[model samples]
Target: MVSFQQESDGDPASKPWYELGSAKHQGTEVTMARILQEQYPSHSLVLAHDVLYTTYTRFSILSMPGVEVELVSKPDLVVNNSFKALPRSAFVGTPGGDNVSAELVPSVEYGGFKLTWKDRHFLLYIVHFARGLSTNTQFFLLHDGPEEPSHQLLLAAGSYQNELHDEIWQFVDGFWQKSSGLWKDIQSANWDDIILESDFKAAVKKDVYGFFESRDMYKRFKIPWRRGIIMHGPPGNGKTISVKAIMKDCSVMGYTPLYVKTFKNFRGDEYAIQAIFDKARDTAPSVIVLEDLDSHITEQNRSYFLNQIDGIGGNNGILVLGTTNHFERLDPALSTRPSRFDRKFLFDDPDRPSRRLYVKYWQDQLAGSEDISFPEALAEEIADSTGKFSFAYLKEVFVSSLVSLLKEREEGHDVSFARCVREEIATLRKQLDKPQGPEVARNSQLAMVH
Candidate 1:
């Protein structure tokens, strides 16, 4: 047994053996080495990185998570650089203080680890394990030292076979909490529950994921792999929930959600933005969510924010999704420029059909709740009284109505409370929807001047 990268200059790129995986690759040589050392703790194990050619590469056609994105490998050897493993166990110091157990082993960076298994004549085991946490296992093997592809072979790792990596983050107290830090348990209301406009869903499908799948077109057109979306319109609409749904859907395609609570959370606003984008780009094909775009990306720090997104060699595979109540107030750079936020989907008041469906969605949810009666005609009655409310408003309407009905039920009042709840919701909507009076606008201007 010997160390593959035993007597080499620190320069890994100099080698002509093989190429490296994309930045998206998970496992590294250090990880493989750790596992190898643990498996044969007593035995002096030879450590080497395997170069996976076409033939030796493994293909996992069927698995729990079928056809995973891992450095695949099988039991095979390359022709040119023949590997000769000695049965005798020994250790000797090599150059750069990295002691080798045998003679020359393959030199690699972030690839699979090759080591002798049993007999002297036994061929090398080139394992390229898919390195991730999930029930859908890869038996992830390794390859190059720190800059190459790998395959899953040889070593039999135990419980690590089932690892689940939760990739949702939050910015809290000036630092970005990595995936494990924040609320990993995400419960998104069923897509059927949220009443979204027709065009909104269609455009999002074509704009975001379509853009993602069509990466070849981007390469041909020489465009960056980043998309920005502005989900605007009323406050209570399905903006926030819709964003969560996007995150859940995008996760299937490997787009982790990174939440920016507020610029105020950052110790320094400027560095915070840089850190956010840096992490986003580091783990590309990620979703950077700014729930309140106008509030966070204000006029004061908008310039710095713009520079972060518009920097040279702009973000690749980073989808910057922003939800703004005040769409017009958002910096023009975010909306005016096509590249910055290519799409703007409004969560306007739900139309008649949408409102009816929204109530039906609630009815389906409340079907089992025997506390109150979600009568058949109640859906239309509520929709008629609400007068074109947003998803959020409709939600509030049902919540308030349900609460009122519950109170009536406790008091042994008639179920007719639904009508009162409906009337009250209509009245509440009118007050919230009132156009800004002249005094309010004038005072806003005066406050700004000060």
Candidate 2:
């Protein structure tokens, strides 16, 4: 029988069970290991416990090949018949409209089940121990054969998790989680939707496409195959949209896109950095998107981040694409370093031609709408008048003007859509004259795109 060994000088069996206060019991309760031994005397037990920085889950382990797991009809004597219900929300997009659906997923919180692998039967119990403020989950596998084979089985289960093709892996809260919603959200982002200089757009695409396609070229030259590119510019430019378009294309090209939301977690930032690179190495030929890279890297973690990017362990076949609104905030080691972030693309304010193209994009959108009139010549006029305005501000001018026009139409007042747009642009230009802080600017940018 497997037992929980106490580190201190105390009898483990004499200790009270953590959940004893939940019920009224006269006698002292025994451990689950003792109960398992008394209930199944013929089976040998193998215990797998969670360690620091490592965790094992039933779904992840059971997802291994040739392992068939089924819920037992009857609950074990030691474990209770309780299940945890978690709420899951999903967006269903269709041709008609978008609908959000919510459902509860009932999972076994404390349960025992049977599994068959290679014609051998085994009993498994999932146990959760409440320690002060946190919970630790452990697995108990009972089999008839020797302990070595059972240990090997557990090792195999812990070593591998099925690769996800339909979902993108995101590192958040110190864990690599599957984000199917992000993958779905990027599907609509295409290169054609981006408004930028033709040569600049082609350069961005060629750099990304060339790195992934030229592995043999790097081998012949005897150079490292990894590359890092940074997109730096003012807020509300095309940095984010460009990144999304590239991510969508990379997904189509069969390279996994791993997005890092943050590097701060319960564990130190250094640990998070290590875990991030480890996952990236495991999924080589992958693209890592670090949006707001300036905020993610600080003086404390800059050295460690650089080491991981071009460290001795080698970052082969991994492309690191980072975006930042404030390029000056980045350290020289990161921005100026050759191998760390080899190339930098400046996404400054859109030129007159790009702004005109953006206005034309809106014209095409409103071509079918009879309520709004956006003529061909107004595109050039709007672009000319909207000087020094970021894409976010331009978008706000359009959206706010449309809203004002709708209100005027509802009040039985005839208003010209083009005049409303020109007035809104003038009003926004006044706001731009006043000195704005970073937080205010960030909020304005987020409102336009998100």
Candidate 3:
């Protein structure tokens, strides 16, 4: 594959080597060069004084301009410092739904730039000078090659980059599973939508928004531009909703969302932690949403998981937002450590005022309904009656109430929406106070997480 054009200036043993890529290699020489021009560079640096240079003889007749070149190591760059290598082949279809014939050789990661002059379809790896002098800096070029290429390299680098940006994955068992489209569903609630303790809301707002704005501050402090947050409490309260709000808010600010369903999804792979951390690094400023964080970390992989957070490979701009119903189940090292889950937010069951606010929220949601509307006084009364109700139970009161009305309407009886709403609240209180069925226990469990 090496075509020695001539001795690399003054270094006789270090000859400038060129290769004419065929159907077998990374695109045709020209095709690879074209693709390389669009590659999101992995790292960029300047070549200063005392760097090597190999000038091509064909361009010797032209004015000896200062040689310049560009190098891109990754297929995509989602955000700043968010760059990574692509795989050699893909079983998944491209965004365009076409058969993607991309062969992104993970090993063949050298930056490239195109050569332009005299209609010559070729790739020339020239060098340039920048920054200050250093022995580590290097530059070189290959001159000799066939005038044309056999075929274009089918490296769908562009497509591959696009796919990862739009969708993320969990390597559960052998297949990739898509979970938590939280970003898209953020429209369901905003800061004004959820009813939480005011101080809690203020703190959450400040941390989430302030973190993104203070990235430079993080750098100045020589700290990683990353944050860890834990939302814990009984299920059916507001942990998941808060997490979604964070997801939506972060998305508006242009951070990518990463969802990890559980630790067991990795299925005991030695490299799972590394791979997970690597993906987050490649997509910096990403919100890693890990549901049930407490149960995911067992004694077996706890140490390994901890290493990834503060390890040498820890990435900047990563916001680790985890939600857990059981705080007692989590390790103190994970929940208490400032470097791991720095801040913990408790989503407790609704208090009296919160219960009242919950009723108001439902009223706001149903304001446009034509058939019936719950009055402001009635709403407050409903809130008073449901003092101990979680947001989940409050939601069910309305839903079950509507179902009862539907049944009455179907049976040709007059539907009294107000009566049904009030009755459903009383019925729910009794049912919750005295639970018996195994199915109800399972449903209660589901409601808590819901």
Best-performing candidate as measured by TM-score: 2
Per-prediction TM-score: 0.57, 0.77, 0.60
Q: Which pairs clash inside model 3?
A: 27-153, 225-317, 235-448, 236-448
Cα error, residue 199 of model 1, in Å, equals 3.3
Residues 84-158, candidate 1, lDDT per residue (tens digit)?
453344566667897565555442122322333221111122333334431112223322232122223222221
Model 2, span 1-450: residue lDDT tens:
333222253322112333542555532213566666665677788877655343325234556788887754342324435343323453555587855354333334455666777677777766565554565666778786667767777877766543564677888878777777788888888888777777778888898999999999999999999999999888887888888888888888887788999998888899888988887788888899999999999889988888899855778989999999998898888888778888888887666676887888788878899888787778778988887788888889889998999999999999999999989998998988834323222211112110
The true-versus-predicted C-alpha distance at residue 160 of model 3, in Å, is 4.2
lDDT of 3 by residue, 1-450 (tens): 322232233222112212322124432334433433343132122221121221111222112232232222123111223234434454457789976454342211123343333433223333221222311222222333431230111112112323433334443442333434433455586778777766767877787778878999998999878888887877788777777777766666777666766455334743556556776787677777788887667888888888887756766888877888888888888877888877777777676666777777788888997776578878877877775577888889989988998899889988777889889988888977834222211111111221
Candidate 2: segments with Cα more than 4 A from true spot = 1-38, 41-58, 61-107, 116-121, 131-134, 143-162, 434-450
Evaluation by TM-score, superior candidate among 1 and 2:
2
Error of 3 at 111 (Å): 30
Ranking by TM-score: 2, 3, 1
Report RMSD (Å) for each prediction in the order shown: 16.7, 8.5, 14.1
* Local error of candidate 2 at residue 273 (angstroms): 1.2
